[model samples]
Target: MEVSSQHLLSNEYTEVYRRLPLKLQLAYGVGHVLNDVCASMWFTYLLVFFHLVLQFNNWQAGFMLLVGQVADAVSTPFVGFHSDQSDNFWLCRYGRRKTWHLIGTVCVLVTFPFIFSPCIGCSGSHQWAQIFYYCVFISIFQFGWASVQISHLSLIPELTPNEHDRTKLTAIRYCFTVVSNLLVYVITWGILHISSGEESKIGPGDAPKFQHVVWTGLSLGILCSVIFHVFVKEEGALGSSDVRGTSLRTPIADILRSVEVYQVAVVYMSTRLFVNLSQVFIPLYLHETLDMAASALALIPLIMFIGSFVTSMTIEKLNRCFGRRLSYILGVLMGLAACIWIKWGSGDQFKSSQIHIIAVLIGAGGSITLVTSLGITADLIGDKTSSGAFVYGIMSFTDKLANGIAVVIIQDLHKDPSNTGYYRDVLTYVCGGSALLGALAVISFLKKVRGDPLGYENVPNYNSINSDVLPVATEDIQPSLIS
Candidate 1:
């Protein structure tokens, strides 16, 4: 009797494991902390580093990250494919995902340092040479992240089939992510100490300051990799007869044919795009345009995630009372409102309080959308025949492609030089418009979800965060039982 994911929400399945063991949840979730913190170090600071430190223009800097996202998007499917098919010594010894995790962590450590503090042909003359240098470095760094991250994600399903247990672990992971994000805020933006005029004199960025970011990424990766590999375990990953999802159908065709699945992808894409845009710019808005010190900059992510933590509880209740659609609509509206403030309220001096309010609103909105969307995706894949891996691959692809395109648009749109100023109008309209579009998607999502064949509408009662946007429903899922 293969239980569908929809069954997991019911009482019979939910209590199979009321909560995962403390040790397992902690180890698995902390792995997420490592992945997120390292990635955050890049997202939060890399653009600023490129513009300020590497002498890359706004487009050049944006191009590097966009390229990185491209590489990450391209490699992720291969990673899933290879993870399933590979018969390497590591797969034999350490299990499928663990082998890649170790390999990926090592690559992350090696490539991460080069991103912020590169030694590649310090040629001051050829702009192409530097562009090529950062592009390769950034792409490889992002690829390594995908390698480890995709495997980390696959573990959530494999670790336990109990919905309650898996949800708890997901919550734990998000909490750790909040902490990791704050840690980077402290390490990077929190410590920046330049006076108002110093930004122009040292354009590329401060080497020692960015080196802290690199070292922090490396150390966290090492520690979390050790904890995750040593303490966490996987089943049916390698050398297991019960391994699922060996489908050969055209994955793109499968996803495209399903309107609900495709709409869920849109919601996922829109949310990731808006958040990545915010991540890339908030530092610029704070450190550059507002002329805030490092310490003032550090508190933003903290305030934001804390707001998320505070409001995450009520989001689910809102969903239960008002439905995921209305809850999501409310979240988007809050984000749009915040963008309104950013567009108009931005001044020469940093209004830390006002921005903090914006952060809280965006954070809360993000939390609500994130929670409901995953529930929707999960409902889609809980079927017995669908390729959960393939659907997940599409979702990851959507996230990266949308994020890359959004960043490029922002960077190219506001190609202002360093120390000049952020084009707040450009930034605000773009972000606000993106949020407005997301709200529209949520409305469509609610319409699509109105009559789910698998009773998905009744199942989204989450009290915590879930990182995996990928799940399964009976009608939408058809697991590969043949292989």
Candidate 2:
């Protein structure tokens, strides 16, 4: 009996490694942590920077951000396409993914500081130059981020073929992301709370506090870039090229042809845009309507991500118990509930305890969606990530475009925060409706892609991958603008 058990254990270990190695999992996760921290710090503060500092109108700032996002969206597909087709490029010792990774790092390093301190705005010109400079710098930042993002995410399916392994990586990566975001919130709170003794709140002139994030983001971003280069290993080749879809226009056409890709895209676009709207509005809502302290406003993200990190470990189990689609539906509902409360229940008062509960609900729900969306994307592509650079790039494209639309809608609908109540209501209604629509989109995806082999129970073994590949689907219409 003992010999038999030991043999079974060895076999299990072998199968697990064949799926995804533990070291690679940790390395991928580290890169994800770095990714979120660098990205979130500025995005979280973007509206605040414009509203309180440069003093751009809500619409103006939103439009500025929109331009950058649109530019990034345009570049994502090309970036993905290039990376997918690439091998070791001219003189770069690294693989295809690594080259873009390095390029993105330089872009961020060169442009991040300039974004915070735009030349025109700091030069006392607050008109078109400010707009132009902001748009230009932000575009650079978005493109650089996309360059790193698409390549980095493409490594996931390349690391493993197992659906279960992908889910585990997703959960682990999401956990790291939550922890890092939590740290960002806490650090932001510390900076804001350590007031200059004039006022207990954060303002544009609060340079001393805001500058901390600049230095921290720059330093940590540099360190993480190094870590990404050192740790992330690209498989150099795909296990197979046969995939689902009907388009034969190009390899990118083939990448876009997968049935699961469309399904993933729909769900991702809806929920991701919803999440962005919520994140963009929280500070505005709390600061404008509730008149909450900046430190307290910062605490909400900390609380939300804390709730997410603690429970993120359970995402796989939830997916197991409920199936990925239904588990995602549950998360969407949680987000909807929180959003509705924000719309109606969150009265104009400084209620920390109640707000914390709201944050918990939003955080946990978001965490679930975050993990599943990423896992499903990897699962959809299977082991094709090595050759399907545009797969992840397409996913990035879908995500950024949705967010762009969301920001545009928010910016357009919201004239100003001077009418705080009306603006708050507009934001809540829009964002809440978005959550509802996102849930509906999830449901639609579930109904249409009913028999997809997304769950672990239905997962195919490595050997099950035969020569059959899905042909790319023809683009009948523009992508669904559900968000």
Candidate 3:
């Protein structure tokens, strides 16, 4: 009876999997473009906007970012827990994950524009009032951002059980992310070039340009979402042979007890901290320390993302050739080298060419580590598809909370006028330090895996841990009877 049941389920799984066309895959990948674009601006330009355009102090700007991060941290768990519910809520008629994704898309589309626009009723209000106004909008936008991110990510395990397919999906999603970020930089570059003089720095007059960016991102995001909803069906994505029955949500206690979960969490958090901090500070480093013109703000980041785009395209092949561990270590070394160069090699005086080189290295390194970490996360989850959202949520919770606090502390130090080259120090020590620590954590995790392959019993298909070798070839694994 058990064998027969497994056979029946396998047939159903194959049917559903086969029906998932390439167009659907492409649409699914494009689903998160809005979040990607918003994130680029939030990290790259939020400080610049608040401190320079709105005349907020360093602490104020940092606090606002913290507020958004806190909001995101808080919302992730709720979205994850609910979206994983086996039973349908009213919103789940369209599919549970899709419903949440749509809800998040709506919330972001409606609220994100207000963040960049001048305060409507209180444009000239007291500083505290303006701060309060922006905080409310930032919180809402962040909640939406988390909802979109977690729900979209959870769709991966549900969509298919094949590891290679999962990797392909993740790679495609990240490729879109790179493209979305590139679009943002290109747009910002074009707008800044036309709106301001070459010598002038970005200031209050540039608020409209941010608004323009927000609107463009929203327009593109909504269109892609429509395609996703139309093409991708979530029908065969849950528990049971028919894929319409209840899936047992993995208990939070079970998730907390898993050692591998913690390991992946550290990697994810550390990678995010490295990438986000560098992005946030690069514009400031250019404007304040180097005193580069407005165009450098966009041009430099553009170069960086171009490098990321190239690396992202090739990462899957790299992962196949070399295991996740070696690939990630290589990337971390590249990032560390970039950090060292920014710190000492650039010195008090540097050439434009040197900065461009640093940008490419940073971008390439960040892309590899980030992509590898996320792939590791999918592997860690293995066949535990029921609680996939919750796993992703908790990881993000740690990432956001840590990054928020780190940024706050960094900004407090930045507020001290006596400190020269503070941004440089931040880029070198803080960002570089994160890469080194993350590398250490990766080594620690591998050691633990080697000590006991069963350390992640909850994760059934950790091939990397199961064998002496780190990366299992794609063809060596068999498809599971149950998804």
Best-matching candidate per lDDT: 3
Candidates' C-alpha lDDT: 0.63, 0.66, 0.80
Roughly what TM-score does model 1 have, to 2 decimal places? 0.80
Which order, best to worst by lDDT?
3, 2, 1
- Report model 3's TM-score to 2 decimal places: 0.88
- Can you give the TM-score per candidate against the true fold? 0.80, 0.84, 0.88
Off by over 4 Å in 3: 1-20, 238-249, 347-349, 450-483
lDDT of 2 by residue, 369-410 (tens): 877777666656654444456766777788788787777776
For model 1, how does the per-residue alpha-carbon lDDT over 1-483 read when each residue is reduced to its tens digit?
234555555432122212356788788878866678777776777787787777678888888888988888887766755655436464535667777667777777777787777546575647878788777777777778777877776565556543334344555666667667767765654446443232333344467777876677567757877898889876432112222434333355555577776777787777766666776677777766666655555567667777767766565446556755676678788878878877778554437467788888777776666655654454454431224445555667888877888788778877445633564554477667777777788676656455633223444333353523333332222122112
By TM-score, rank the candidates, best first.
3, 2, 1
Among these predictions, the greatest TM-score belongs to 3
Model 1 residue 43 CA deviation in Å: 1.6
lDDT of 3 by residue, 145-183 (tens): 999999999888777655556777888899999999999
The candidate, 1 or 2, that scores higher on TM-score is 2
